[model samples]
Target: MRKDKITSDELARLCGVSQGTIDRALNNRPGISPKTKQKVLQMAKDHGFIKNQYASSLSRGTSNLIGVVMLNLKNEFFSQLLTSIESTARSFGYTTAIMLSDNLEQVERQCVETLVGMNAAGILLCSVIPDPAYGKQLLQYSTSLVSLGNHICGEIPHIGIDDCAAMFDSTRYVLRHSYDHIYYVSPVLSRSSKENIDAQTQRFKGFEKAMALQPSVHYTVLRDPDTYQSILKSIPANGGRSAVICSSDSYTIQCLQLFKNSDVGIMGFDNPTMLRRLYPQLSTISYPIDAIGQLAVKTVLSPVKEQKSHYLAHTLISGTTIK
Candidate 1:
């Protein structure tokens, strides 16, 4: 009799009807007989089947589907992340349609529209999606969306690490090792009121705040791709200026490649298998990719049974790359 645990499926079974039929009847769509509709209503009330007004409206038209938009899927980190999300969505009996783009704004926008047109129950978004106006469009959808990444914003619920604090902790850890000239390499920041886009700004603020505490330490930022080699070539190998904190595993891997056996201490943001395998001693921040994926699925399917969204937490993993 608890309102929390009652489900649409259970209500449909109690009413001696298929889930689709119950859905149609409950959503007040045409097709089912008046008697069947009445039966479904009485049963739903008896079992305390709370209808998600949004899903009910959306369900009148299409199949249950979840759209996933991801960037850099070919990367090991994203590939692992996608696998975990896909597995979780499957467990909830949802058919997930995925769109992959190499961080192109145009392609990402197209993918979002395509998925929306498909009548997906909800969408799971990650990575650099262009067009700020599109974020407002998402809120209008009846589908429940959950963003998975450090960079996501808005009233829409998201699951990811606290980038500012995570990076601050990582940087403080590096400072504790007594390494000087700690540089943070990250993508250039963008201006937006949206919560997701604000992540980069938060991270930079964390770095600035942390740096202020230790006035003597030096830091610099490098976003230039063409002259990155020249920047790497300028660092001192044997001095106290021997450490660098990168924004991501992808950036760290690039740093490692550019400075092979160059004795420059390196660290990356996300802890990936390759980060550990290639540089077992590399210190980096780590969070559970599988758990993030699982949470995203749980959020999408929650409205199906009229469950509320839940917040998840992230923990940092320590390794040897710092000192």
Candidate 2:
């Protein structure tokens, strides 16, 4: 018989219990006898009686929904990564609930809380929590939870690239090209007890280290949007040979569009499909987005105690944009 087709009356008959008792046992209500609970659960296991999650949750007043919080769904890279995760979740017969927080720490935390309130079976967090105390508090919940891209550090399992290593490798690649004036553009960097890792800081360290070895190259870091636009305005005037690197593909792509003229070399992190197709000359680092999604679903469903931490490395996608 199809599991979803099974009803409470059928389960009660199978377990030799009253419908009321089965309801109490499944819902974890105090009135159900321990002996009866064990017998019902065992029978359910043997006969696949537990397969009807929707009906079961309806009787129990909640569900096994997997909640996902993505910080920047508008970013094409993140959107692709999230879609992969959602697809994996669906394959496992899990319903997904997604919340977008626009990369705000406050909104991210709220999204998590909202998911929990919905009785999530597990939560896949893809945002940085601004408050460490709340992250610690989140551990108290019995729900299975994991983080992606950004993580909650020790409290949660994460599936993502070693941001530090990816940035480092990308920077090293840029430096190897012998761009005399290498620059990095990033969204403003912020420090929080909740966010232990800084992707930009690690990337900057790589840039600095590389430049130190090559004393001849002049290096600069620009975070200002106005300065970025100003720099782009003068790219053609300065000559086409100089290179500019961006921490994000979106930023680099936007800057390139601003200049209109493809005189200067531009490289970005994250090998977005559109970027590669639109500007064949744009060099990038391919962060394994699909793999990250695949691993996240595997890790979240795996027993937390047996979960292993994985760090993916990035690959350089060289293009004619840079020498």
Query: Count of backbone clashes for each model?
Result: 7, 0
lDDT of 2 at 31: 87
Return the TM-score for candidate 2, rounded to 2 decimals. Answer: 0.77
**lDDT: worst 10-residue window of model 1:** 187-196
Evaluate all candidate structures by whole-model CA lDDT and list the values in order.
Answer: 0.70, 0.71
Give the CA lDDT, 0 to 100, for residue 106 in model 2. 76
lDDT of 2 by residue, 1-323 (tens): 54444566788998888987876776567888799999987766666654566566655555657788876666788788878888998887678888987767778778888887777778887766555576678788777778776556576676777676676777777778766677677654434343534455666566666567778777667766556667656666664356787877878777678655655667788876666688776777788888888788778776544445677877888877667
Name model 2 segments beyond 4 Å from true.
1-55, 58-62, 190-197, 304-307
**Candidate 2: how large is its RMSD?**
7.0
Candidate 1 residue lDDT tens string, 1-323: 35554778778767788988987786677899999999888877766777764464365554457888987676677888888888887777667788985566677768877877777778888746545666677677766777766344465677766778877877777778777787777654432332235556666777777878898888777656566557766886436656777877778887777766666777777776666777876677775677778877887667553333343444455665555
Candidate 2 overall lDDT versus native: 0.71
Highest lDDT among the candidates is held by which one?
2
Best by TM-score: 2
